[model samples]
Target: MNRLSTNIFRRSDALKSKPDTSAKQPFRVRTGFLILILSASISLANAEPQNQKNEILAELNAAATRVETVKASLQVGIPHPTAALVQWTEALVAYRKNPEFLYLKGYQPLVPLYFLLKSDSDAFSLFVPRVYKVFRGKNKIFDTSIDIDIALIPQDIILALKPLRINDTDHTEWKLAKDQTAFELTVKDKEGKILRKIIIDSSEHVRYQVEYNDAGFPYLEIWKDDWRDTGSIFFPYEIKMKRSLPKKNELVLKFKEIRPNEKLEEKLFQDTFPKDAEVVELKESSG
Candidate 1:
């Protein structure tokens, strides 16, 4: 006989013992009952961790939903590693969700810079008062000349302040830290490429986040601190973003005033530049 048949015959001979007639039950039935119990125990043990992950995800979504609109006055700091002092400027930023609109006005020394985004139409406008120029475009936000402008992307800015709501389409996996003080949540796209990874503390506040580029490289690392309670939701007063490629640069925003869920005026989303201001329509390079 083959090895497989010999093993089966040995198992059959092993169960050929006399049945326990006193208990009024067959041994095989008792053994089957034990196997069923073991299977149920294993299933429950596997379900518990998944249940915890679901609860954590629900809490994150609940917090994100509480933020509808936010308007803040902030101090923008660009740090130079070689220089002794950091370049500081002031800015006013406002954004609203559920269509996604953002308006940023930066007070530069030479002139004020205005950036507006309307996600519904995928349109963006940049106004530079110094040059009396207004550049309007669609799809792309910045030009190739602006190397350190990734931090100024409207979507990234909004994500840094407001946490993204985990949706059904996003593949998410989380694991608790060894010390159980925090958990790391990794969100990936349908193609299994990591979109972003967030670290949340015990209080469910996002401590840090790493955003990946299209080529699956870490492009930006963000650290959030000094959370402020804005009644409706918790807002991070201090946000620092570190760029990894081309040249390492850091941009920090210190929010002086944060107002959440405020009713923003419609005019804020519109372009109110002077008619005489030279309109420069930025076209996408065919290359």
Candidate 2:
């Protein structure tokens, strides 16, 4: 009888040593389910910010596409470092999208100027009637005396006046203001150099922008205000540009009239240099 009891006790101990797989199976399943939930939560957290950024970009792109042709009459306030008072000049400006062209005619009593840019061909023409001089060049025009640089190029000018189309390859980062009134966006190149920074208001209007040079230096800063709903889009009646680096100057443009999507004649963008004016052709540098 004692021997029989000892064998029975050994059998019971063996049963206890065996694992309770039925309970462990449920625990394993619950752990896996929890991991799945955690993974989904992380995925959603990552997607939300990207979705918001895409929405903001879509709004800006839509507004830009609404503007095909623009014609405006504006008064420009030009400030000189040596002058005590700001010089104001009236100007007529025309811009065409797609092929991208810009024409500007400034009326000043002493020095009338005309500038035309054809981005498709990468050509530019500048005519100064008072001096009887015409400069035709390819790429950029750099003349410190006239205060003309890459900022005057059609691309840069349009970027200042309108919202830029951010590409997929561009590295973009955005943050909401502490007050939650506006969004600040910084765009960088593939190599992580900043290209531009913009501040957009709640109404999706770009209130301010600072454009950087290839070396990642801020060369131009622009502010747009006095926004008005023009049925098709929001337009800014007043724009200011502060230039730095190569020169320090301020240009304020107040639009008297703006016509968007106007049917403009092709000749308006053509360079019309007088036959009597001396033409200077600038060639590209070889290195």
Candidate 3:
């Protein structure tokens, strides 16, 4: 469902590790890359299912109050790690400034919107949907048929937004302000995972303090914490995401500017292809 958004990579050099144990490792097969094969759509799994409809309506009663945090919870599961030819973490980190390839990024609301989560091998996807056009990197004039399932944020507010995937629970937690910010929580199905902790600041402007414990590894810290007043509410201006445990993979995105609640052209939401482009076959991930 969200193979388009995870930004997973296929680094050639990562396939070579020391000792050269297996002189003949078959074609590079990265579990991480293969994890992206499983997909998802807008109709996400929110366990709240039937009841959440009522909850959303109930929250709309005031229609003028604040809602706190929002999140996507997916239990981390991996049959095995990716088969990289070598351990290239240090090499990649040293010169990753120039990534050979990049996945097309989708939408992530400056303001909290609903998220659709699809779990893959070890990696997962969460996306915010809308009707819009995306210009290709090569030709800015050409429009592409794209339904992105991932979003990015710059580093900051790692603490403010306590992102978590606990062993138990369906809803992620965000400390709601007194008629201020609130959230949509996400947790994992891992037997002993503890939820990440985030403290929301709803004073004049909103901010957070997020932290957590994973497999007894101490990884508690506040990150890229910065917020801006969006007239009606407050939101993080700087945000970042990374692997919380077992690994140090990361994704960082910065918002050049944010335009809110704009109308979408009906044509964009359709599967029509623009002229000069091939009609790509898009599979349906949802029933």
Model 2 RMSD in Å is 16.2
Q: Rank by TM-score, highest first.
A: 2, 1, 3
lDDT at 262 for candidate 1?
91
Model 3, stretches more than 4 Å misplaced? 1-194, 201-224, 245-247, 272-287
Better of 1 and 2 by TM-score: 2
Give the range where candidate 3 is weakest over 10 consecutive residues by summed lDDT.
88-97
Q: Which residue pairs clash within candidate 1?
A: none
Tens digits of per-residue lDDT, candidate 3, 1-287, equal: 35533322323344355337334432334454444443221223222334443444343322223422222221111112344322111000000011111112232336233322222222222233342222222211011222432222112122223222123233343333333243333232344354544433423222333344545443434334455544543445454444333233334333333322233333323333234433233322232
Position 174, candidate 2: lDDT: 82
Query: Where does model 2 exceed 4 Å of error?
Result: 1-52, 108-120, 143-155, 178-180, 282-287
Could you arrange the candidates by lDDT from highest to lowest?
1, 2, 3
lDDT of 1: 0.71
lDDT of each: 0.71, 0.70, 0.31
Highest-TM-score candidate: 2
TM-score of each: 0.70, 0.70, 0.29
Model 2 Cα lDDT, one tens digit per residue, 1-287: 46645755565555555576544554555576668768875665444355567788998888888888888898777666677777777888887776777777778666556443344456677776656767677644432234233334444556556546777788888876544567788999899999999888887788888988877789888899998876677789998888785556577778998888888887885556688888877654443
Error of 1 at 247 (Å): 6.8
Q: Please say which candidate is ahead in lDDT: 1 or 2.
A: 1
